[model samples]
Target: MLFPIFLLASVAAAATGVIFKPGAWYDGLRKPGFTPPKWAFPVAWTIIYLLSAAAATRVAGLPGAGAALALWAAQIALNTLWTPVFFGARRMALGMAIITTLLVTVAAMTVSFWSLDRVAGAMLLPYLAWLCVASGLNWRIWRDNPAVPRPAA
Candidate 1:
């Protein structure tokens, strides 16, 4: 029950990536050398979504899970917002801001989840690691491409 709900939320968040794809604008960005290859995004995201959903499902019915669940929702909402802000609007700085906030939120979520279920907490480790990589990438793109113009309304 909870697993499906969490998976649905992840799928919805992933839909944004499909909608605001990285086409010419992203291709033109001066990304860091550490940027993962183009093929890695979806593959990594697939694993991430599964792991995060599992973690949330594990913690969902436990005692004192309300705040942890809220953190999970916050992180997911932040995750959903990043794609459109970065790819659709071409607002790297704002995207960077979102990702940074997401990173913090996930960190807090990870800790909260850990307190509820150690395995669930451990499940978020990969997500935290990925967020680190993502945050660095977002920061680098914003820093390296100083003159990127936002898309017109």
Candidate 2:
């Protein structure tokens, strides 16, 4: 039950990607040599999100889970914000900022979860690894697409 609840929340966040797709703006970018194939993003992210939700659920009832779960919530919110910032709004710098925070939150969550449940911590490893990849991608895109305008904040 706990896992399902957390998974549902993650799915809702993941849904944002569907709404704010990488359309023509992304298509025209001079992607790095390491840019993943078009089909890979969704595939990788789906697995990562599910694992992250399950990891959070596993530790949600632990004695010291509050901070961990709060970090979970924060990271997911940042996760949801990325697609809109990067793809929908085309603000790569802001997206990078969001994801940078997300990366830190996720690393903290991984450590926090490890203290409570090793298995749960292990579940998040791929997600952490993937975030590293994503951060690199975001940074590369920001660097390569210098002409892209960021909205005035």
Candidate 3:
């Protein structure tokens, strides 16, 4: 029972990227230096999601899982929204702003989860680290490609 719940969380997170068709937009971009290989993202995210699910499961049994879950949901919504903002809408600058918000929220979630379950909080560390790198990348991408047109509404 617990395993499935965790899997659902993992699947939900995994599906967010796919729902936005991240690959197609990602492939179209002129990535900045140090952009990890295309393959790296899936692998990294898969591991990250699995760890997150584990953490979530741990937290689920605790008292604050409700709040933790709410925070997690909010972060995931922001996470999913970024792909379309950056890729679909071609608004890297705005996407950067959105991702920044996501990062802060995730950090809050991490702290909250830590209060409930230390291991769960620890699981989110890598996610926060990745977002830090991604935020920097988003800023650079927007800066370098200032001339790129924002996709029409």
User: Which candidate should be chosen as best, given lDDT against the real structure?
Assistant: 1
Write the number of the candidate with greater TM-score, choosing between 2 and 3: 2
How do the residues 82-149 of candidate 3 rate in per-residue lDDT, one tens digit apiece? 87777777788889899999999999999999999888899999999888888888887877777776
Model 2 per-residue lDDT tens digits across residues 72-95: 999889998898989888888888
The total of clashing pairs for model 1 equals 0
Pitting candidate 1 against candidate 2, the one with the higher lDDT is: 1
What tens-digit string does per-residue lDDT give for candidate 1 at 7-114? 999999999999999999899999988999999999999999999999999999999999999999999999999999999998988999999999999999999999
User: lDDT: which is higher, 2 or 3?
Assistant: 2
Q: List the residue pairs that clash in candidate 1.
A: none
Top candidate, metric TM-score: 1
Measured with C-alpha atoms, the lDDT of residue 141 in candidate 2 is: 93
**Candidate 2: misplaced stretches above 4 Å?**
149-153
lDDT of 2: 0.89
lDDT of 3: 0.80
Better of 1 and 2 by TM-score: 1
> In candidate 2, where is summed lDDT lowest over 10 consecutive residues?
144-153
Question: Each model's TM-score, in the order given?
Answer: 0.98, 0.94, 0.85
